[model samples]
Each structure stands twice: as structure tokens, then as C-alpha cells.
Target: MKSKSFKRYFILLYPFLMLITLVLVALISNISLNDILMAAAKPLTSPFYRLSFIKEFLIVGLLSVAMNLSLSMGEMNFSLEGIFHMAVFLSALVAIYFANFFIIIVLVPIVLYFLWQVPKKVSRGDGNKLIISSLIFNYLILGAINYLVYTFFSDENISSAVTKDFAFALDMKLGVAIAVASLVAFIIFAVKTSLVTKLKIIKDAPSILTSTGTEIKKEKRAIDLCLTLLTSVAAFLYLFLNYNRFSLQSFTGYGFDAITVTLLARGDFKKLAYPAILITYIRLLSLVMQTEFSFVSSVMYLMQGVLIFISILEARDDRNY
Candidate 1:
């Protein structure tokens, strides 16, 4: 029974599947698999590098899990992009003045609690309304953030159109520890607890979930609110490691990789880690290939576009069949 439940959690051998796909991609490009693995293994080969990779993976994994919270509930909270940047911008403003703990305890949560309303306001109805409203509210938040930053901090050197170093930031180690903790908490909440069963109802039988008077809508918003808080906290911590301050640019365009990772994982939390690593590697490879490998970034993106188009075609065919 335990083994069966474990299999259900992990689904197929995802780690092996990722490795095989990676090796095939390497061989097709005529690159030595050893070299590719070695490059990816810099984290293991070097301790400092390992921390960087761990931090990176934890960020990706956390974002994926956060999105899964809402996506599993048949919702997509795009305001996460806004929430992330707003917290990032807000972090710099507050962290520059206060101690690290004060920033984390007071400023971070306060910003998150307010920005949490954006998703609640935007994601009113499901389907296109959800997507469009999310995008709309996301921009609205970005605009407000931009105005506040410009109006208040326009003359301040600590946080303006330029980036500046600051004191009282989370060290990479502590940031990574907190990120791991967040991911673990999310895993327990999503997987080990009964929330998964409720989420399944939302995903597979929304009508039933609604009919049961389960207050699932309230639950869904609460979960999204929690996720927004988590992602914002991590974003604030990331400011300490790098990018202490910057202009109020949109982070909405970011985390597109999370979507890819979540889709590949298919809501299997245990399957999430391997794909997160793979997508992160793909992201890094896209950067690395820009300079050395024969495949330039444009060519890589073109190939990706082609593959995505074919996948869409295949999906359409399956649906029609």
C-alpha cells in the first residue's frame, strides 16, 4: 500500500525521464554528455556554486508550488507577477531603513496583505475572464507601484531608476533555508494533507465542489493569498542576495518557466523537482548556448517555438479524436 501510494505521488520515473531527454538533446547537438553533465554539476563540484544552484532551484520550485496552489483549484493568479515585483520594490524601500527581521516581519507581510487583494479582485470568474482580469489587475498594480516609487523615491538614491547595494539583506544560505522551508510547508499543505482531495474536486468536479457548499472559493482565495505572501517573501530575500533595488519594471513577463514546469509536472508534487531542475538547466543552457554553442539564442528560441507549435497541434488532434 505504501509503495502504491508512493508511485501515485511520483507518477512515472520522472528523474530518469528528464535525464534521458537531456542526454538525447545533448547527443542530437553533438555535444559530449559528460561535458554537459559536468557543467550542470558545478553545483556539486563546488560548494558555493551548489548554494547558488540550490537557491535557484528552490526559487523555481517554490514558484511552481505556489502557482499549483491556484492552478490546481482551477484558477490562475497572474497577479503573482505584480505581487512579486511590488514586494521586491517595497523590500528595498523598507529594508534600507530597517533591520532584516523588521523588514521580513512588518513590511513584507503588510505589502503582501494589501497586494493580495489584486488577485481576489482580478480572478473573479474562471476561463477568459480570469486571464484577462488577472492581466488587467497585474498592470494596475504595476502602475500603482510605479507611481509610488516615482513620486516618493524619485529623489532618493537608495531606490530609483537605478540599482544600489544595501545593508541588512538575507544571506544566500539563510534565503535558501527559508525557501526550502516554504517549499516543504507547501508540499505538506498540498500533498500530505486533505487539501489535495479538495483541490481534486476543484479541478475535476468543480460543479460538485460548488454544490457541496464547501466554501471552496474562499479556500481558493486563502490559498492564493498565502502563496502570494510566500512568493513575495522570497522575492524580498532575493533582493538581499542580488538586485537590492531597481526601477518599478514589471516582473509579470518573468516566471514563464514556472508555467512550463507546472505543465510538465502535471500536478504531481514529487514529479515537480526533476522538471524544475530540467527547465532551469534549459534556461541556463539557453544563456550558455548564446555565447559558445553553435546554437545562438534566437535559433534556440525558434526551435522551442516550433516544438511548442507541434505540441499544440498534437494536443488539438487528440482533442478532436
Candidate 2:
């Protein structure tokens, strides 16, 4: 029984183990103690970088929870990446040309409403269709957005636009408050609500719920809206915090990163914070390494792959037990 419990909670320990591995790797790479200390202290020493990281943590955390909630019901919304990016991009463009910061208040809902309709019309409550349609939509949307950015915006124009009030629409204190509240609210919705029980039934035995007159598609559409709302807010907060340093090439692949975090949490919303913190730590560390130690950018991708691999191995072990 003790061993079983250990096995069950081992994922919570995995992040620390990865941290140790990173330390060992640093040592092997001739990183001095002072360099390590400086890297650790860098974000704290720079206010802007620190605020950027805080925003990243909140953004990624919200996305992870949203993804986990959807996956719990056997659906995956890959279009979140598109929605997250496009909403902010459109808002920024409007703010740049029209000089109106509040334009995002209109743009966000419009973009989300458009995206929200795609999966609903295409999938009709089938999880597999939702996955395929969202994935394809994600690619098309991202490609089109990037093309427009590359075509119309020079680097200087992009820089000027980001430096304007558009990015800093919300003061830092208010932004932080909203981000924290959003994450907390979503967690409670996932863990404390009765809707989760219905979602579970839908996951494990959809036919059982269908026989009892449960509307599987309706349940899924509700989850879909919740997810879009979170992603939209996350994108808005991200623009407020990081848009000053944003780039046309600034996609974070966080849509997929959320998947790895969710898998590590083993479908438990209560454990979601652990994996979210773990992924955020890895991201911070990756940035530190790249900027301070001159490490290659691909190091972050490698670390992400390692995390998914470890999660897969643990998942296989669980099945055996």
C-alpha cells in the first residue's frame, strides 16, 4: 500500500528530480557556481523580466488548466494557441493604427466567438473531430496571421507599436490581480463544481450518459466556451505584460506545453498546480540559460521532450500496477 501511494504521487516529485538533473548538467558543462547563482538571481534583479515571467506563469497555468479540463472530457482544443495569439495581435494592431486601447474589448469577443463557432460546427460533440478540426484550424490561423505580420509590419513599426500604451493597458498590479483570480477561479470550477462529475461520466462512458438523456455535445460546448474565455483573458494579460518585448516570431508553443503538464498531472485538477509550477520553472530556467549562459534556444525544446517522455514512462508503469 505504501509503494502504491508512492507510485501514485511520484509525478509530484519528478520536477525536483529534473531540477537535480539540470544542476548536474550545469556542472558537467563547466558552469561555475557564480554563473549558476547569477542565473538564478537574474529575473529577480530585473523588474521587467520578473513581471514578464509572472505573466508567463499565469498564462501557461491558465492554459494548462483549460486543457486538462477539456481532456478530462475526452476533447482537446488545439485552436487555443491561435485564439491566444490572434486576439492579442488584432488588439495590438487596432491600438497601433487607431490609437484606441479599448479596441481589444471588442476584438477579443469577436475573435473568440468566431473560433468558438468553428469547433462546434465542425465537431458536433465528437472528441476526435474536435481534435482534428482544432489542430488544422490552429495551423491555418497561425499561418495567416504570421503572413500579415511579415507583410505589413516592419521591425521598427512593430517595436513602436509595442512600446505604446496598447501593451501596458492594464497597470501591473491590476494585471497580476486579474491573472491570479482567473487561475484560482478556473481551478475551483474544475475541482469543486458538480459539472466535473458529469464530465467524468462522459469521459468513461458516454453511452451511459447518453442513455440517461445527458447531452454530451451540450456539455462539451459549455467546456469549449469556458476554455475560450480563459485563453482570451490569458492572451489579453500577456499583451499587457509582454507586448513591449513581443516579436513577430514570438509564438511560445504553450498550447502543446499545456498538454505535457496536463498529462503529468494524471487528470487530477487538484494536482494541476504542481505541474504548472514545474513547467514554469523549466521555462524560466531555459530563458536564464539562453540569455546568461549563451546556451542554445533548442535546449528548452529538449527539456520539454524529456518531460513528456518521463510522463509517458510513468503512465505505462501505472497501467502495469
On TM-score, the leading prediction is: 2
Q: For each candidate, what is the lDDT?
A: 0.60, 0.68
**TM-score to true structure, per model:** 0.68, 0.76
Task: Write candidate 2's Cα lDDT for 89-141 as tens digits.
Answer: 77667766676756666667666766756864799866556767887887788
Off by over 4 Å in 2: 1-10, 17-30, 41-50, 77-79, 98-110, 113-137, 154-168, 183-193, 242-245, 306-321
Off by over 4 Å in 1: 1-49, 106-110, 113-123, 139-161, 188-193, 242-254, 287-321
Q: 75-148 in candidate 1: lDDT tens per residue?
A: 65555656666777777776655545565656675667666655556555534456567657767877887777
Question: How much does candidate 2 score in TM-score?
Answer: 0.76
Q: Looking at model 2, how many pairs of residues clash?
A: 0
Clash list (residue pairs), candidate 2: none
